[model samples]
Target: MEKLLKAERISYHADGKKVLENCHIELRRGEIVLLLGPNGSGKTTFFKCIAGILKHSGNVFVDGVNASKMKAHERFRLGVVYSPEKMRVAENLSVKENLAITGDVNEAVEFFPELKKLLKLKAGNLSGGERQLVVLARSLISKPKYLLLDEPFAGLSEKAFERVLKILVEKSEEMGIAIITHERVESVLPYVTRVYSILSGKIVSVIEENFEKELKRYLLID
Candidate 1:
């Protein structure tokens, strides 16, 4: 597989305190990578930095092209789609319209057929699971080369989690993916090829599937 996204010697600071320091991670095309850390551990910060949502000192490459200086829209055009930590759909727009605005409803539906029926409902009116489905569906319209999702499973029911997980895992073969979550690593363990656990703003651990239990132990929140 080809490497799609790489962050090297990444560091960030705010209010005179370092938020991240000398952190590194790689995402290969068609691969799913996990970013696990406790709150304030720089997980979300890493995602924002890569998506150009925040500024930082580092190098981020997409498909061997350096993209650290690109604007968020430019990065998106380069095939990087970021689903933010908070749900961000039009509250007043119908589901179909939300996707239609992007001009790729059919592509989104190809991954999440269930969205077809919810097309008439406003995004705000959907349940937690349904809302996430809408978000995920809209994200695919970009046909991204890389997808970064922040806490996507939060507030989702067990069944909904499974449903979303299946689509994400399947979609990984077409795009590199990085998902940030603090718990329930089991939900993605089977699909992930590499896991990076962040501690004190650094990637303290990088493990493969065989070491999942240890990784979980290190990141398990009380």
Candidate 2:
């Protein structure tokens, strides 16, 4: 697998307070990697940095291009897509309309056929899980080479969560992915090739072997 992205000695601060320090990570094409951490562990901040939404001291190379020096749109053109934990869809728009804006309704519907019946329904009226599926559909429209997801399965029921994971697994096999979440580690275990444990603004551990088993222990899998 070819290297898709790399972060070296990355650090971030806000209001004169250090939020992340000396963080390093490497992502390969066609790989699914998970970032595990508790709330306030800087997982979101780190993701923002990768998306070029936040400025930080260090180097982030996307396909060998320095992301720090590139604009967010430039990074997007490089196939880096970031989906925040919160849905940013247009509440008034129907599911189909929302997906049409990204021109990926067909592809997205394949992963989440439930959306077909809800295509004409307003985004604001859908359940949390439904809304998330729409957001994910829109994100994948760009056919991004790298996808960053933050707590994508949050607020979803067990069945919905499993469905989302299925879609993620399929997409990840087609592209490089980095997902951040503290729950359902076992659900994502089979597809994850690497795992990173973040603590107090830093990557405390990096495991590449038996990642699922290790993650189960760390996440206290029952």
Candidate 3:
């Protein structure tokens, strides 16, 4: 319980093969790690090599330093938040002015209270689940400690994917989550404790018990 995000032995190559060879990930703090794979499994190239955006070989500790010599906005000011997977709002601004350019949304409006009646509409006229709940309520008011979620349930709506796994399991106690999904680990199965799985490129399995019968016998879940 001392890995506030760590990637060891992470490998990658091109022009010659091997997309990611050794691959590893820890991420703790409060917990919530689930990086399944299938699409060129490197899980978004190990979240772009732990958000430093490419150029990686191994080692990427965050809270324990050595974050590839930090850069991506200094590892996002050391709090480290990367919510990609196509999430960017402010199409014309409005959902409370895009949470007022990310200052405070009263705890992301208490983890999205239907975004307080769509703040006042506009976010490009909302809808893909209210614009992914205003780009995940401005990434939960930018209070991340290590968030890094990617495909947040694609286009959510099984009640907004259970209200975004109950607001990232209450923002993972204090936020130290990592969720790159191809979906169906029974949808964040009980806020996932641990589940790796990446095939071809490495980390073949880590499931931490049952996990829906090991994603239906090795990621065949559909």
Candidate 4:
């Protein structure tokens, strides 16, 4: 399959300090790619570069076109969506209102039926997991072709985590996905088709098979 998003030689500097160097990555439809690294490993910075949020040095192509100079909304128009690790929503707005701001939530609710009952409640009133569901639902509602998620599983119970994972798996059949999560390695291992391990802002290893062993070998798990 042709890659939906391609980034090459991606490097970034912050406050005169190098944060990422010569990073390359690609995403294709119908597969879920997991990005693993410790804190300060430049995972979030990498995602921002792809999403066109942070100015960086690199060639980013979407659907065979150069997106290196595109803005965040332009990238969104091209079907690339990045959800930051810090979940954001209008606290005073109702759950339904937040999702409605993006678009129709019918399909979003289909992916997360749990949101049906909580639609009327204020977004701030919901629990962490519930807020996550709202955020994921809103993202899916946009129908992005390449979805970059940073810590989508933060603040969730085991059952809630499983629910979100299932939704991601189902969505991967139609859209390209990349996820950055630092928790529940065992639970996420089975769902990913490939894994990229990054350290000190550079990709160190990529594992396509024997994830459990390779993850340990790469020191992503101990």
Highest-lDDT candidate: 4
Model 4 segments beyond 4 Å from truth? 1-3
Question: What do the candidate models score in CA lDDT, each in turn?
Answer: 0.83, 0.83, 0.78, 0.88
State TM-scores per candidate. 0.90, 0.90, 0.32, 0.94
Model 1 local distance difference test score: 0.83
Candidate 1 residue pairs in backbone clash: none
**Model 2 lDDT, residue 202, Cα:** 94
lDDT of 4: 0.88
- Pairs clashing within candidate 2: none
Per-residue alpha-carbon lDDT of candidate 3 for residues 51-150, written as tens digits (9 for 90 to 100):
7877777888887888786667778777777777765677787888888775686667777777888788778887777787777778668777888888
| Model 1 TM-score (2 dp) | 0.90
Candidate closest to the true structure, highest TM-score: 4
Off by over 4 Å in 3: 1-8, 11-21, 24-34, 37-49, 52-67, 75-81, 84-98, 101-147, 150-202, 205-215, 219-222
Q: What is the clash count of model 2?
A: 0
Q: After superposition, which runs of candidate 1 have C-alpha atoms over 4 Å from their true positions?
A: none
The digit string of per-residue lDDT tens for model 2 on 101-200 reads 8667888788778889999899989887788888887888868889888888877889988877877777777788999876787768778788888888
The TM-score of candidate 4 is: 0.94
Comparison by lDDT, 2 against 3, better one = 2
Deviation of model 4 at 84, angstroms: 1.7
Better of 3 and 4 by lDDT: 4
Residue pair clashes in candidate 3? none
How much is the lDDT of residue 166 in candidate 3?
81
Q: Model 3 TM-score?
A: 0.32
